[model samples]
Target: MRSGRLGLSLGLDLLGARICSFDCLYCEVGATDALTLAQKPYVPAKRLLGELSAFAASGPPAFDVVTLGGLGEPCLNTGMDRIITGCRETFPGLPVAVLTNSSLLSQAAVRRRLALADIVLPSMDTLVPGEFAALNRPHPDLSLSAIRQGLLDFRSEYSGRLFLETLIVGGINDTAENLDVLTDFCRELRPDRVDVVTMTRPGAYAMAQPAPPDTLARFRAALGAAATDGGVGHGPAALRSRVVDHKGPSSGPAASPHETMARVAASLGRRPQTVKQLSVALGLPEDDISRAVEALAREKKIQARAELDHVFYQG
Candidate 1:
C-alpha cells in the first residue's frame, strides 16, 4: 500500500502474528497478543524468501521501496538479516527500509542486521520514564536509558539514512517538558529527518487522541530542520512539500466480491480505514467496499468505531 512516509511501499511481514516488545496505547493494529522480548524465527527465513521470490517473479506492479514491517515488530524475527539480504536480492534496484519500535536496538546483533537496510525508521515517543511506561507499556526488561544508548550507538555506527519518528498523543507526550527533552534528544541523535505524527486511526486505547494543530506546529518549529509534518491539519502546502502523492496501485483485472472482502479484511488488519479510504486504496467502488465492510463486521472479523462524523473499520 502507499504511505505518505514511504511512497508505494511493498511491505514484508516478517512476523505474521502480533508478536511485539511493546503494547503501545496508540497501536494501529489493536492490542498485542504475544508480548515478549525474545528474538526467534517466528516465520522461517526460507519460507519468507520463497514467498518474496514468487511475488517478485509474478510481474508485480511498480513500488518505490520494499518495507520490512507489518502488524508487529520486524526485528523480533531472528532471520531479519537474511530477510534484508533476500529483499535486496529480489528487488535489485528498490531500496530496502525497516520500521522498528526501537526496543531491541541495544543489541549489537540487531543493529548489525538493521544496518543492512538503506533506511531505518525508529520511533521514540517520550523520554520521561513515566510517560514511556504509560504510553508504550514496554517489556519489563526495557528501560529508557538503555533505549537511548542504543539509538546513540546505532547512529554513531550506521551510515544509512535514519528517520526518527515521534508519535504525539494529546495530554501525554505533548507537554512542554516532554517535548523539550525529546527535542534535545533528537538533536543529539542527529537523525537525517524527524517525522512528527499523531494518531489518524482508531488506537488500542480510547483516550489516545490526535494533538491539535497548534501543538504540532510548535513542536515542528522546535525540531527545526530535522522535522517533517506528517499528521493531520498540517495544511496543503506543507503536505505537498513533505509527502509524495501516488494514484494507488496500477490498475488490473477486477477482483471478485469474495476477493474484495478478503482484501478489505487484510488491509484493516494492518491499519484502520474508512470506507471511502478503502475504496480509493483498493481501486474498488464505494458500494463494493461498503458491502465488504458490512460482511466483515457481521462475521466479527472487523469492528467499526465512529470518530467525529466518519466511521473507521479495524480488525
Candidate 2:
C-alpha cells in the first residue's frame, strides 16, 4: 500500500494466516508463518466488512486508497471474491487494489477474483526456472511454466490496470540474461507500466542484496517507455512520508526492549525505511534504531538489505 504526506492508504491484511503458495527468499514478512496452498477465509468477509463500516462510522482516517494485501498472499484467501465484491458495492468511489505475488494467477478463479480490483500490482521477479525456484521457493506443486502462462492468460482476460513489479536482487536475478527475459516478458504481457525496483529493504534470506544503481539503470533502459522507478504515481518516494508514527521506543516514554522491537517491526510492516529514516520518523535516536533493527534481525522478525550507502529494514 502507498501513502504520502497528502494522505494514507489502508492495507487490509485479510489473510492473517500463512496461506501463500511461495516461501520467497526475499519475503519481507519473513518465512511463511504457516505455509499452505489451501484457499480458505482467514479473515471472514463479514468480519472485514463490519470492521470497515465501523471504522468509517467512527470518522474514517484520511486515506486515499484501500489496498488488499498482507503478510500472506491475498489471492490465497477463498473469500477474496466476496470481500472484493463487498468493497466495490459498499465504497464505489474508492479505488481498491490488490498486491499479489502472481503465484496463484494460474488458477482461473483467482484471476477472475483479482480482476474485480480497480488496480492489480503483480510481481514477476525472474523467468528462469531454476532462479524462480531459488528466489521464490514456491510451493512443491507450483511450476514456473504455470506462473508464466498464468500471467499471459490474465493479461489477455483482465481489463483493469496492471502495474508489473520486478524486484532486482544483486548477484541473483541481476544477470544480463535474466533482465533480458524480464524485459521480453514485460513486452509480451503489455502491462500499463513496469516498476523496476531494487531491494531497498532486508528480506527473509540473509544473503539477499540490492542491485547496483548501474544495474538498475540498465534494466530500466531495457524496459524502455514502460519502465519507471517512482512508478506512475505511487512509488517508494510518494509512499514514504508521514505514514509511520513519530513517537518511538527510545523517546520520553522509555519503552521496553520488547516494545522497541515491536514498534520497529510494526513500522517496517507498514513500509521499508532506512535506519536514519526510521529514527527520524519514529522520533528515536540513530543508535536506538540500529539497536532495535539488530535485535529484530537476530530474531528473524525483520530483514535488512544494503542499497547504495543505506541499509533499509523490513519485515
Candidate 3:
C-alpha cells in the first residue's frame, strides 16, 4: 500500500514521519505537521531493514530502483547513510536514489551522505529569494544564498547522475523574467538532465496552479538543451514502462465507477487529499482520479479547495 507514486521505484518511506525543513505551499504530502532542521534517526535502521527484508522475502520486487523518500525529506534522517548501505546490501544491483528539496545540500556533510546514491534528484523551483520564499516557504534560517551555494558545491563534488527538477506555478514562477533567470542558473549548474514540471498534483497552497502547456513549452525552450517534459523519467509513460516491462501488466481489473466514487468519497469525508494522493491511495491513475473528482464535484458530492495552485478534494 505504501508503494505508490513514481512507478518502477521501490519508494521507502524512510522518514515514516513528517520532518522537513521547508513547509512548501505545494507539498502533496500535506502541510509540514512537524518541521525541523536537525538530522537524526527518525526510523531505526533495524526496523527499516526488517520491513525491506519482509517485502523482499514476500516476492520479487517489481521495481527498477530503490527510492529513499516518501512523506518527508530523506536527508533529515541521521541514519540515511546506513539505510542506503543497507538497501544496497539487501537488494544488490538495484540503483538507490533520493529525491531532495535541496534545502539540506548547503552543508558539505549532507552532500557527502548523498554521494552513495546512484541518482541524486534535487529540486530547484526558483532562484529568486522572494519567489523561493513564496513557493518553497523554507525554514526561517534557510537563505537563498546558502541554497544556491549548496547546489553549486554539490554539483562540483557529486559524480553521479545529477537530475534537477523545477516546479512551476502559473503566476508565481511562470513569468518571463523568472524563466530567464532560471534558464541562466540551470545552465551554470550544468545538471545531467532537467525536468520542467508544473503543479500536476494538488498541494498545500491554493495558488499552486500548473503552468499552461504553452507556458511549460516556452519554459523548456528557454531552459535550453537539458530541459525535459517529464520530472524523473522522460514522461509518465517512461516511468510506468519501467515497471510494466519488468513485472508485466497489473493483473487486477480497474475499479468500477461506483467503487471508485465510494472510495473517493470515503477518503474525502475523513480528510482532503490531492488528486495525486488519491491516485496513490486508491491504486488508480491520476487521470482516473481527476475524472472521478470532477464527477463528484458536479454532483455536489465533494468540494474542492484551492491552496496556492493545487486543489484539495473534500466531501
Candidate 4:
C-alpha cells in the first residue's frame, strides 16, 4: 500500500456481495433492480476473512480508518456491527467508519446497533422539504426533517464520531440559500466533521454533476470556519490497486457486467465518463451500461474515484 488521497481512509466492502435498500439516483452502479434488505451472493465471508487477514499480515497498518461503506449501503448489511467490532479486536484500535444514507438510522433499534462501531458517516444532502425530495429522492417513508434529526440524534446519543456527508449536486443544492440551509443543519447537529461534495460519477441522472471545485472550496471555507474543529485520528493512507482479474462485460453471477465495468474503471484511476459517453463509445444502451459497470466494479475492473461533479467510468 502507498499513500493516496481521501485523507488516509482505508476501505473494505464487508458484505462479500452487493445489497441495499435504496436505488439511489447517484449510484455509480446505475439503477438497482430492487431495494433489497436481505443478503445474497458475492465473495463469501470466509474469503473476506482470508483476504483481510492476508492483507493485514502482508503489511502493518494496511489502512488508517477502515471504511464499511462501498458498492452498497453498508448499514443495510445486518452483520456490520459485528464485523466492525470483530475487526477492532483483530486489528486492535483500528478506527471503524460507515457511510450510510441515514435512511434507516431513524429507527431506534438501528441507531442502537450502530453503537458497536467507532464512527458513523451518514449522508444528509437535503435540508429543505423539496430539496430533500429532488436530491436524495429517498424512500417514500422518509423526510428531510427526519434525516436531519436522525443525524442530530445519532451524534447526540452515539459515543462514536458522527460525521455527516453532503453530496452537493449542481444546479440543485449549490445555491446560496441551499448552502445556508445546509450550514444550519450542520450547526444544529455540530457533527464531528461535515464534508460537502458533488456527484462526480456518471450515475443515473445525467444532470447529476459534481459540485464545482470552487463550490466545494467555498463551502468548506464558509462552513469550516464557523464549525468547531474536531481532533484528528491517525490512520494509514488509502492506496490504489488493480483487480488482477476484472471480468468486464460479463454475464451471470460469477462476474456480472457491472463489476466488470467498475474493475476497468478503477484500474483507470478516474471516474469513467458519463454512461452516455460510454454507451456512445461502446455502442450500448444507457440501461445496460450499469450492468457492465457493476460487473467490472465487482471484479475490481473499474474503480469510481471522485473528480468534481460527475463520476466518470474508466475508459
Clashes of each: 0, 2, 13, 52
- On the 0 to 100 scale, the lDDT of residue 157 in model 2 is 95
Model 2 residue runs over 4 Å out of place are 1-7, 226-315
- RMSD after Cα superposition, model 4: 9.1
Which of 3 and 4 is the better model by TM-score? 3
Residue 48 of model 2, lDDT score: 90
Q: Model 4 off-target regions past 4 Å?
A: 1-7, 15-18, 36-51, 54-59, 230-315
Give the Cα RMSD of candidate 1.
4.4
lDDT of 2 by residue, 169-263 (tens): 88888888888888778778877766677765557777887888898788767764444333333443233232335332233566667776787
Report, for every candidate in turn, its global Cα lDDT versus the true structure: 0.78, 0.73, 0.73, 0.58
lDDT by residue (1-315, candidate 4, tens digit) is: 111223334556654333556666676555555556554433344555566676667546524456666556676666665667656765786676676878776667678767777777677666767766776666576656666676677877888766666667777777788778877766677766666655544665666776778887877666554445532221111111111121112212443455435443543342246555454333345677777776666766565655544566563
The residue pairs found clashing in candidate 1 are: none
Give the C-alpha lDDT of model 4: 0.58
TM-score of each: 0.87, 0.77, 0.77, 0.67
Q: What is the lDDT of residue 152 in candidate 3?
A: 83
**Deviation (Å) of 58 in candidate 4:** 4.4
